[model samples]
Target: MKITTNMHEGRRTEMYACGAWNDMIITDYLEMAVTKTPQKTALVGYRVHAGDRSAMSYSELDRRITRMAAGLAALGVEKGDVVSCQLPNWWQMSALFLACVRIGAVCNPLMPIFREHEMQYMLAHAQSKVVVVPKIFRHFDHQAMLQGLRSELPDLKHVLVIDSDDEQSFEQVLLQRAWEEEVDTARLFAERRPSADEVVQLLYTSGTTGKPKGVMHTSNTLLSNIRPFSERQGLSATDIILMPSPLAHQLGFLYGLMLPVYLGATAILQDVWEPAFAARVVAEEGCTLTLGSTPFLADLVDIARDEREQQASLKTFISAGAPIPGALVEKAASVMQGTKVISAWGMTENGAVTTTRPEDPQTTAVHSDGVALPYMQVKIVDGEGHEQPAGEEGDLLVRGASQCVGYFRQPDMYQLDNEGWFATGDIARKDATGYIRITGRSKDVVIRGGENLPIADIENTLYKHPAIQAVALVGAPDERLGERLCAYVTLHDSSATLTLKDVTDYLVEQKFTRQYLPEYLEVLAALPRTPSGKIQKFKLRDMARDIFQGQASHA
Candidate 1:
């Protein structure tokens, strides 16, 4: 099946004949760009600490990748070998990933913020042999964390450090061997190239519950999700993509690294998310597009509103992770001038399955995740696997080229039912126009007074408040209401002391139903978030359980 045309005239083209999944992987696109636009700027890294910037043209990046692949080969890395990376959005991370692909090694990218415990679990689960990381990031001493985990992780054979002042720096490896000295292992592993069905990465979901689950993806699965967005957004070599999302996260990997390079576009990478810094990068670098979480967008909007010329070159803002409030969407569109604010929905298991297209109507663009990408199928189904009628909300099940192969080492979680659909764990509804609106996570729905309450609705509503920095609503056990809404709020400014009355009064003003209003409010200095900036609601649930237990003891 092929995407025909946009509503506009003369915008049609036959889809590339590559298999649905094969087109999305970086290897195919990397080879294409190296041949076609070797001189184009493939990646640009902006350093915050030194105020120094660096860039690599496609030809240069390809050469460095070849050498790096050779370096890995020297270290005994082979096809299916897991090479874990804990670097930020630097050029080395991108180069290392391509090197892994060139040699058919599975790239296991971890957030730089991960400490000993998280690193141990990821390395052990993936059985990663080579771990590449930074010596220090922010205040976290990654070297110490690596040292602590190195003993227990028997499979870890090498530790490659980037941006380090220490002896094990990545630069040392390249300097020790010239490009001519290293063999091009890309050809040596040509026959072993990961097929469209083979796993390329073992991405761990933010362990909000139990231990983190490793979501496995093949080259085909990764590309299938990317191709649709590239086609939908009309991504091109002329566009400069700036991604504030962590490269470790699925969105960042697809949009920041793969999608931009897939289209031969320049990709601008930043190590961290700072609204002011992002604004400067977008404006100075002439970034045409960017994607980030709702909070990132909110912060950018606030920054743009305060500064007159912020994000002047940005043409598109892709918001995901959490609900994009209408106000933030409007603010982004207005500030960016001709920019479209697109709401996208997906998870670690599936790269963005649905997103608002460039030509979508404003209402649809603002409120919905838009239509499913080509080669992807989505359905709203009841608990028993029966499809629900249009305009009804149910568990969202998705199947497509981009769907993950399965969880690593967990075959039980990998098997699909006889029907072949993967349960997405999200509750969503499709309108008559085919736009999908995510209602809430299956676990996020609060059953209050025998009625289901959508947490997303309440959270989006709370986002409008001037003092509320972040809000998450979780269900707490209640004797009367079955389950009651317990709001965990983080204030924008600590000086602005708030109370339960302050929250209830604001909800009343917003016209939230009394039943939907939070029965208890816990004011926190900050919300616990994963490395990807997703709110750790499971932690809040634990806190709520403790609050209830303490109250019960007193009673």
Candidate 2:
């Protein structure tokens, strides 16, 4: 786990001394829960195989983590090693986090949607020693995919498959056998227990560049955000969290898994995002809270109205990754009578920086992404670094304990000023009371349904197509999803024509993730350009919006 650091040891010690970061790691909390509430249900995972719903109690989870950590150690995983897992919301993911903590290994969680194109670079860059994957997910053979990649990854020693019944499967190798019995337990703990300041998690996020940047987080930085956020949401030990967002993402990793462990509460995970299924789970599990994007809220509101037998105990819905449309907030209030829909704004670099409180006026969620949480600061500054007056949009900057340590293996990419403020590539305006409304992004990327699509990567791949002369990918307005990818293209030959299917097929041939293929294609004679020959993407965005609105109205 070689990675970059934003703060030196002196600065970190100073922050800790000032009480910005607590000394306890997540494992400390897990042990506390095991001692205090050993019989309480700690996790419930709705896995993809056979629609199985699995639950694990605190004591049982701790025992499995000990075994799994020993098993990993026996397989040559040492302190400061990088262990990557490309898994969905599952019991294995939770166990792996604890196991990594137990062994002082860095945990790198990859999104299940990433294929060979994305996986190869991330794993290779991180120099991951081992990787865990499902045998198959969403009809894709993950084990087979990793098998194909292993020859190229010299550092990737072990490939553990979760649901396989073979000799090398996760169940047979890590769970069934008690490896801890063979190892010196006292020596392992003495040698491997990680400190609060050590980097524990490496998560990849889309940026303006074609390659995704790996955001690094220690237990202290992550919990710094989670503690304040859970407090503001009125969460407690008795609350059960119903999480539908992918656990690999920061939103789910913090609130779904880590938050529950922090509070000694139960976490119910839904691997697939089906509105009806989620509503049913909430009713069955007595879920009191959840955090997701606008799309999940929209679907949940739609399904909750028609399902009469499902008794939803859901109290709070914290929406992030996209703006909560005002109309949707009103509609949610109408359908889901008792639930509070809160708007939150943050990125992978800093988790949950701003979120409207549950006690705030209901309409507050419609317009603001709330003020900064405790120990965090958010300010809007102009290009010249001067602070902007209230209500004026400028580059959004943040500095806090919750900010990530730095990007992994990319020291030059880490941008922080002398004052420790990291410039987030978002344009926003702050109100007099310190609420921020994100107006636009300065980064060249598109966020589709809370997942940020790699815009430069897609455009670069499309540029390789022989039939295309110029291409730009813009996000078109979507009602359910916040935006859909729209590819605007000009042909190399005026007589040649390209359709949406053609573009998608070419992208698939290039091994692009099919989920991100552009939904709309517009063939223009020439893309709008500045006099200096730069692509005028703002004009293209307006065009895409009008075209999509027009087509949607006709439909």
Candidate 3:
């Protein structure tokens, strides 16, 4: 692995340590804000739907956080406790996250889309004692889901519903309670804050394999990951960040929530991805920094192209989650004024591993995921784990302060074998200029426009259909979507009639979003299998490609 320029300058090491990367935690940075600029607007949560806006000054934000910390303590949320939160991009989420850290609790932020099954798995695995969720959001029955999960999860004790139009409101808890009662406990506990190495967050990856693994991250790891990128991008108090990506994801949390607050900048939150609304946010709020997935960027570009007033304030548009096609990059550059489409590559295991530098040559941004951030090291290795020469496609490995501590409770899988590097599971090539380009994932996961759709989950869901005897979910290439789900179904009886619509409709009823639903379905008398009786998904994938191509031509 080659080290990039000035990557580890301010990194800390033990008295005898030699590495460039420092070990620090989230509190280290929060204290900086309190000490330097306590009067600045640390966070601002605007509810565009309700025409309501709220601002939190740095000092006030810190105060509210302390109060929330006290409140959590009253609920019996102790240190090392897993606090699950499924809220939108609101001020409460930010305040609660900081409060959790203040009390030495691991923050488990989950997507609001997660239903009973997903919530059950995450809550059970994390052993989350407290869950904070919105009462109802956009017609989704969140309260019902919480009710269903309470019985299944014995460890779960406290259920705090945010934005509830009821007596048990988040405000009532803070306003009605005697702050003096818990203030000393919170302050005393805050004094004994966890070290940088202690896990601050247990972020679960949207697994494309078995169950999702909880990626544990410490404060030092997160700060090290963000410092270089923040400094490099010149994130400051003047900048206003517009993030459409769900805060549950790393990019959204780091950039949308943490980065802006860390830099004394304002973070504009949008509950849903509405392009017209996104453009309005940029134009109206004077948003200078925006981060999202490829599809989100595409939608923004389309909306901006349609609305002439859009993109007047956007300066940097960070694209991650999946590859940003060169054509879309060019299109965005042409459509938006003073905006650059920057591609980034990373995972839940490590935040923002690689990114295209803003000042890099146009060719660099177009061809690479940019150079490694300061303090990070990258390498390409063969199947035998030997280093590959420059420009050769191999498994991408990275080691940095930002790298995750390890999978929660899965210690055996955490350590890097002799090499002191974590396998990124991405196949990439490092050029002479230190630019890395992602080619594919080493795992059998499908990147459908940035969201990793696990094949096994879809297959398992499909198997529930009574008419379907066996199923294999595979990815077929698509220009627009990057990849579309294709399901190969073997019927229980040869005479049984099962159409593609039948499977799709059933999946819809099962609450599998439209994106996960298979675009093409093949009813096979018998699925092709290997000697081990394992259905060859690769063969089915090829068949899907041929079927899609034939259908395209016929149309």
The TM-score leader among the candidates is 2
Q: List the residue pairs that clash in candidate 3.
A: 7-374, 7-375, 12-22, 24-219, 24-220, 25-219, 25-220, 26-219
Clashing pairs in 2: none
Q: Give me the runs in candidate 1 sitting further than 4 Å from their true place.
A: 1-19, 23-25, 165-167, 179-186, 189-192, 306-309, 444-555
After TM-score superposition, the amount by which residue 527's alpha carbon in candidate 3 deviates from its true location, in angstroms, is: 3.1
Model 2 C-alpha lDDT per residue in residues 306-373, reported as the tens digit of each score: 86345358889999998889999998888888899999999999899999988898999999999999
Q: Which digits, one per residue and each the tens of the lDDT, describe model 3 over residues 430-459?
A: 998888999877777877777788677778
**Of the candidates numbered 2 and 3, which has the greater lDDT value?**
2
Tens digits of lDDT, candidate 1, 1-555: 011111111111111343473334577788899899889999999877657799989999988887888788788887888899998888888888888887778899987756554678789988888999887777666777787778899989888776665677777865357743656464665754665556777788764334667888777678778877788888778999997778988888888988887788999999877878888888889899998766677777778877747677777888776556676677766765656788788878888888888787655666788788887779998888788898999999887667776777776656565556788778999988677998766655665533446467568778888899999988775543345679998888987887878887887676444545788998888899999999988788888878886887899
**Of candidates 2 and 1, the better by TM-score:** 2
Ordered by lDDT, highest first, the candidates read 2, 3, 1
- Alpha-carbon lDDT, every model: 0.76, 0.90, 0.77
